[model samples]
Target chain A: MHSESSPLGEFDLIQRFFKAGADAMRSNDQKMIALGIGDDCALLKPAAGEEIAITSDMLVAGRHFFMNANPELLGRKALAVNLSDLAAMGAKPIGFTLSIALPKVDAAWLEAFSKGLFAIANQYSCPLIGGDTTAGPLTISITAFGSIPSGKAIRRSGAKVGDDIWASGIVGDARLALAALRHEMNLPESDLKQIEHRMHNPTPRVELGMKIREVASAALDISDGLLGDLQHILNQSQVSAEVFLDRLPKSETLQKQSEDIQNQFAASGGDDYEICFTAPIDKRDAIDQISTALNLPLTRIGSVTKTAGVLEKLSLLNKNGVLLDETKSAALLKSFDHFVK
Target chain B: MHSESSPLGEFDLIQRFFKAGADAMRSNDQKMIALGIGDDCALLKPAAGEEIAITSDMLVAGRHFFMNANPELLGRKALAVNLSDLAAMGAKPIGFTLSIALPKVDAAWLEAFSKGLFAIANQYSCPLIGGDTTAGPLTISITAFGSIPSGKAIRRSGAKVGDDIWASGIVGDARLALAALRHEMNLPESDLKQIEHRMHNPTPRVELGMKIREVASAALDISDGLLGDLQHILNQSQVSAEVFLDRLPKSETLQKQSEDIQNQFAASGGDDYEICFTAPIDKRDAIDQISTALNLPLTRIGSVTKTAGVLEKLSLLNKNGVLLDETKSAALLKSFDHFVK
Candidate 1:
């Protein structure tokens, strides 16, 4: 992006704020970046028998985040969501390209954004390679690249009948923070402080994803809530699933909420970057070993089944084994649409 | 993108307007794509001993083009500009990802846009592998991938002293049409129609770029005018160049203008997707032969030189070899910055 008052070109702005951080990330990690930054096009040389996994996401201000949301967290959230896609595919970190359109050039905002971006990029060994900056309403579009061994990528279409469903870490806390921020619900300041990070800065389940490729039959990062996003797996794999309402994992803060609120948010809350996956019933022990080894809470919350005569492919049952009614199910199925009413 | 009145979801919108085109493209071309749309991440497996070239460009409405510009032409131009980057690197287009943000979903607009997008994608055999669409100010950010033999990509940093400078096809017609469109200049409707495609749908010299890689010492796509974009090659190669005003190529429409207007635009027209390249003196015959074989014009316009005694790395000289004055040169050097007035 550019500002008339600022005496810097687009390349100068990138070099001053972002390029240094990218170079710093390179020093600490060796990746498949044959060329980074400052080229007509960056080059990547994948190792033998490796396929590059690519995914892109676009985040617009006021739609994806508050206009006044902290620039640092906004930057981190942008890349984190993309990394989660790579994680869902069971790919190893390689590099990423970011395209940002700013209303104007703000030096302080740029500095903080770069800091957040590089912090996660370094942690995951993904370096910034090539991008474009322009003048427009604030929007961040990132396309991340990762390497996966041939035939090793996990897909949402891989779920099979008689598979155990799993969820990585906790869900619902992010939506809880969002509710308080939107003034739709009230929460103590301390409670908001404890849960806000879940919404603002999500940790990609990349390591867990790569490790489970051998065990998990199907996987997807839960972005648009469990009940809504799991429908994607069901639709693609041509299977049905039943999730036990009482088995969904929750953080300590979310557990304090009312039973209705906990179940509602956990099952249908958007912005939950946790992974929901399915594995063969026989691999439950191996999946548990991976969960213990990584110290991540991988809870068995459901089971995949044949869709024969099932009313709903993704059925959310209550604590007493009663199916959620059509009206409530339809409401929760709305998910997160940018343009739908 | 979506409409409150439209029943389709995001995936449905993409599937209806884009997925079919992508599938059609895949049927005609066999590229490195291991996965196409409907997945968390697309997979590209670069063949052994080859590297991938990646570039991204963002075009914002009212900045890159007129708000009323044809949606079809706009779509074609978006992908064309990105492919030009790959062409500049002497890479062959493999695939691309498109991220679009639309204010609202208009079926007619989307149909025409997809028509233009798939036209070029299929022509170049660069299938649409993955992307994201959302609701926001209309913005299209594209990241293209291309394949190049390892260690063979052309770079702006490769020009050496005494290299011959060349420009592909004509250079100023795009800006000539832009001047008419902006009402900064007057032109007959016939002339406007003739030159409008130069501005709206400039072709990428992918074939010529791939052919001349063996001869070109340095290469870059001229997007922000030849005089302005050439400075990048000079700067990166730490060299100087001289361009003869009489040698600059102009379309018949641009040639019919006043000498001052012709020279001014030919040297400094923006949105020109032509390539400006440098090659060793002996490689002139090789380049000329490739030009003849491809039936494309490759005009020799200048020469690269050492910067030890040259005040300007990129000097524009008149017919008698007189250097242009600083005042005029500075005026032509603005080079289309998005945020600057």
Candidate 2:
């Protein structure tokens, strides 16, 4: 896939691929991006009484995806995952910076990659601003910027005791796709087609996140799996959680799996890019209306509680109110840690 | 260098190295960073009438540095290069995000790396507000944020004809150090010691950039050689330049090199985090005062000109006012493009 032409200088490559992508996808974020690519630094001018929300994420070849993964989907997923972080905080998409290390320049690959990147960027009104390009093993690092009204960002530390834990959309399909890809499981053609997009093009819940700011006391995107990601809110807010294991939201395709597989995958499916949030019990009706309005499932799966114990920041319980044993719970899910297996 | 106690998960690794670095180096940028680590997104709150400047740069192992390079200095240079981008825009550093991928967790290496990162971060009051850590071949990506008063940033497109071009500090020591390291040439131990630090630890002229904003019509930091980087200003401002090769700044150590070597390195040395700027001839005295107040050498090296031709963006001449032959000028420098040698 390497190009046969003369080596592309960094500037020419950037202008040919990324700059063209950004220019085609130029959004209404002019107030946020005062100056873009072509300068030493991009200028971000926020409106009065607003603050910028920033997050960074990195994806490495072979680790995050197969070395042969589609460049278009890879580029789309790279930016989508970062945007989901902003969605978790109820922030409006503003702009992003990309720093990529490539094995070599490939013209066709870059063309498809830029197409995917700009398609999603334009959809979310998030513009590309500034970045660095270098030569190395393949890696893509994106730092996404979003804006929120002053003092209005929903934070992971805001969950309180007695809050209801809610999750947006389905969670397990992406994990299932991974299993199939790894050859640990086999899926019928129809099933793979039904669910593979969850592993490829995740839909960042930007509008839902912005709309839920008043409802969710605390929130985070479930990129690392539901139970593990929810632990972040519990640990940050200094609260404990009791989750009803059977209540996890799952797609129709995921429901066709065995009971054990469904529960485990639904609980710990990394790359779901769904929102796991906590809110006061009083906001249940409002949340339901929001879910309906957005045509997305907002499932109530658990509740915040006083400390269960120091070793246990969160707990999984059967619908019968019996706590799952440590062995079963441990086997079911833990957040996906990049450094760990 | 691997740690045996346990595998450091993403969050733990981040908390152990980067968060600790940031906490120790916490600066008064609390006004800019409203929220820091342990959140879905870090919040940046720019004060009244101020805008944010953002830039990202990535450094990869084996490509940007040796596999066995000093961890501490590597960490320092990574952030230094990015902060220099802000300095080019005449912005005050506020905060930054780091996304790192490592082959394995080395506790000692990370400790030293974090120490070096925080040492300079604290010096500049540029706190680390957020970051992501993962496992892969070593790569470090940083997106730094700075604050500039609205409409006050020095941009690359602002250079005017007859504008005097200036460069901050000496330029070729880092390149000389690189040559020594590569064994392309040899230096005495004392000379090597004097020049090596220029490569290991570049000082981003932050305060000088802020001070020169009013005087410099256009500005950029010299990370990628002076002549090549200046081409960016000329390209943006639709101007050309005539540089006096003998007037290019060099240290006493660099002056010991052959005249041809000195001229080549000074004109096109990469990784020198000095600022190159342009201002109307009338502002020379003001720029001189800024240089004196900062106790940094500000050298007048060239002047902006109308385009000589489409292909020739900049021309270099000797003291006799004769333009250097195309072969010599071509031999001297082209911006160091990462994709090329």
Candidate 3:
């Protein structure tokens, strides 16, 4: 994999691999990118009345992904995860910057990685702008930029009491795939094949997020498990939540698993990339319209409640509508934490 | 140092270290950062007619710094390097995001690191908006955002054949410090103290860059050696350069070194973070006025030349005003390349 006579130097590597990838991935809707990768800094001209939304995510080999993970999938997943953050804020995709550290410059690996990065970037109209390429342990950090109308961004602190908590698409399939990958569970090859896409290439709900901007009271994407991420809303909004397990959405592949597996994974599974949100109960019809218009499921699984203290932030209920004991609920599933891991 | 018990977890770590750092570093002039720290995405609302300039830089532990280096200086230098990129474009300080990968969490180290980061951030009025933290090899990647007038950014492709080449402040001091650290040379304690700050903490020359925008036809920050980085301007502008060896600026400490050492390090040393620019002969008076107003020295070092082909892209001249022979000139200095190193 190491070539002593490689013609590409550091700058040449960026211009050839990254600059060319960005040029090919340029989308017509992304007029905000006034300049791309060739200068000291890229210029972005946001529209007159719009505000820019920015978010960054970093994925390190052996920590965020398997050391033997495919370069193409890793590239796509890195950008996809950051896009999910923008989607949760109801921002329109504009562009993104990628900082990657590679152990070595393997031409074939870079070719596949750039192909995957541009594929998803073009699909979402998020053009590649500027970034840094360095030599180190394999790590990918992407900062995605988007635009939204001023004061219209969905924030975590906007959830009000009695608001309906909603989640987009299904959760837990990605967690299930991870379980299979870890050899913690034995699954049929067909089931693994069915759910692998959720783990490798989960879609960012950009359009759905934009459509529900005026309807959703508060929002955030599920990355560190549904419960843990939702706690961000509870903490910020100073509210409590009671989630009904019977109402939690799941894929048919996930439903085939045992009840214990379904409940646990669906509740605390990370990497869902699905937007968990809340809205006033009266806006249910408007929310349904967005669901039909975008052709994406928007499932209501709980209600926001006024909180007097932090101890009552979350309540978990079983399928029969009975609140589960705190100890049993807490023992069901474990969320991933970087420090702890 | 690794500790058995860490006081902060994932979310609390961000809240205590990063978010609090940003809050303390907030400046009044940086109103463009409408939202910061706690959110799915940070919101930035650029003025109606302004454009955003973005750049990112990454530093690996062993490659960019000593393994036992100070964390505080590392934090400051990480953001300083990105600010230097914006300075090259004559853009105003706005905000930045930091993505860090660490093997373990050390509370005292984090506290000092954040203090250093905020000290420089507040000094430049650049607030911290959003970023990601993950567990991996120690690495810092910072992406800085700045605002510029529409169509007014200094670009490398704008240099003309007769443009005067200029550089701000002194050069070679950082490389001298590096040499001392590598045990390649020994210097007095006073000399080391004078140059150590240049190597570890470089000022971005933000105000000077902004002041000389209209006068400078082309500009860039000297990070990868003066000659190599000037090659970027030459290649982009399709012009050659003739730099006088005697005209290169050096501090009193640097001048105390041997002539060979002085020439080699000043010409090819990296991490200068000083602005190198080209301006028309007619703008000389204006440039001098800017130097006086900003209290920063701007020295003339060379002139751009019309080049017929890439082979003669740069020419080095001695104090006698005669072009040096190619072999002798080429053997004098070497620039750092990560892949090669």
Candidate 4:
């Protein structure tokens, strides 16, 4: 993990970590990139009818990630995070440019890192097109491109009141991993492995995202805490939501944690890289079909309401089968409070 | 120009130096760029009938430019340098992404720097698409994108041995500016002003490059000095050139410098940002027309020869009709050599 002491110079680092990773992933049926990775520029031919989607993000040392994180995982996460942006917009991944600044080059670190990057890029069919490398503190900035049909992009502002709120896959595991990294709590090695995987290797739901475009009214990826991220949709769509605490999809590892910690992690912890989208209630059956076809879980956690406030609380019933006010129960999970900071 | 002491915080620095500049540029009509500079990612529509051209370059502090050079000029130069790469391949400027690592944010510096960036971007019609900002040592990396009609790009490998060599505008001013900055030579204020402008703001020959695509066999912009950069084209094309020192275009300011200094400046100083290209003899007349229409001076310095060496001097008869071995002419410039240790 101490890559700074490795023997690879910058040029070798580039040859090892960057050059091969991009070279092995050419899109099928798409006109292969004319020039990629090692040249002054990359050349790409557009498909006959589609448009390109481009996005960029910067990760700085000691700012974006922990200083001692595995370089291989870091490279993969960088590409994965950017890909999530494209997924959120319903675009198909195409190619990307990387701008890396390093204090010094380490050969072993670069080889592993580039291998990791290439592994994911190859899986997703995104080619490494062009980029720049320079000497400085560790910083990686990537601009990823994708393609989509014209006028079909799903934006954050499309959700409407009464739309059913849905999220794909599990949540809160990444946050738990971060806590584990900090050594705040002891957990079994098996659970630790799962949490670490969730933290370092997020799988952007690209297929589900593309399919959701046909059924969801609005969409965005959850990079920040779920509450804060969903708030973006609420603010943009002018709606509020009341998520049912009982309906949230939690990982088995998360369920094994204390209930209060799991609740806080679900509401406040970020980096899930999962799609949080909304659709009309009538499309629930269609969503179920999509979920089944993708073999991925999709949960209807709540409904968007015309009201302005977001509420989360446990439900209770008296012996007479009458619903009871659970004002204090809201404080138990602290769902709304988790995202305040 | 020590921007580290300026009052601006990081966020304001980004808004002033980056955002303001982006706001002034015109959008590319050929592609669908849904979200450009303001968002986390730029949403672009792939050009339906074109191929994308991408290039990137990094300018680092204490390596690329003077430590105290104006930050505004530095910002603009970052983008301009990358644009020069696109120009080398005859690509139409589209958009660019910037990854800037700064030691500290300085408001006034950012304002001037961003204004410089916007000025060039507006002139070239390339918009600021997307990028990232980080806190680190001063470094700027720009990844620029452009497009060309499919299979229409000009490349360095296309030059033939019998082609004529041509360069646009004048050279040597940028190198002279560097000398002046170092206080190695004393010149009049007017002369200093002219040379400094060349150093601070380089004009990438975009229009000239696009025009040359029709007539030139191969092309590249002059950044790493005319001799070294032209060698790239020669090496790639596997041709040798015999450039006539007398026919080289020089600025009045350069002509006023001491002969020894002028030779060194012209031979080794980089950052000219002029287009150096090769064309078959048959296209000379048509290229002259293009030069005239564009109001740009095209100097025919020499021709590509069957020989494999870069001969800076050619034996030729002087103005008095006396033959001289130009190889021994003290007027011939010697290349500058700088070693990094």
lDDT of each prediction vs. the true structure? 0.88, 0.88, 0.87, 0.73
Give the lowest summed-lDDT range of ten residues in model 4 chain A.
A332-341
Residue range with the least summed lDDT across 10 consecutive positions in model 1 chain B: B1-10
Q: After superposition, how far is residue B80 of candidate 1 from its true place, in Å?
A: 0.7
Q: How do the residues B68-164 of candidate 1 rate in per-residue lDDT, one tens digit apiece?
A: 8898998899999999999999999999999999988788899999999888998788989999999999999999999999999999899988999
Best DockQ goes to which candidate? 2
DockQ of each: 0.62, 0.63, 0.58, 0.28
Superior candidate under DockQ, 1 versus 3: 1
lDDT of 4 by residue, B73-115 (tens): 8867888988888988889888887777766655666677677
Interface RMSD of 2: 4.2
Residue range with the least summed lDDT across 10 consecutive positions in model 1 chain A:
A1-10
Task: Give the per-residue Cα lDDT of candidate 3 at B111.
Answer: 87
Candidate ordering by DockQ (highest first): 2, 1, 3, 4
Task: Report the error of model 3 at residue B163, Å.
Answer: 1.0
Residue pairs with clashing backbones, model 1: none
Q: For candidate 2, give the docking quality class from DockQ.
A: medium
Give the residue spans of candidate 1 off by over 4 A: A1-6, A309-312, B1-6, B309-312
Give the Å error, residue A266, model 2: 0.9
**Per-prediction fnat values?**
0.75, 0.88, 0.79, 0.45
What would the per-residue lDDT of candidate 4 be over residues A119-223, giving only the tens digit for each residue?
Answer: 778878887877777666677888888777766677777888788889889888998988887798888888899778889899978898789878888888877
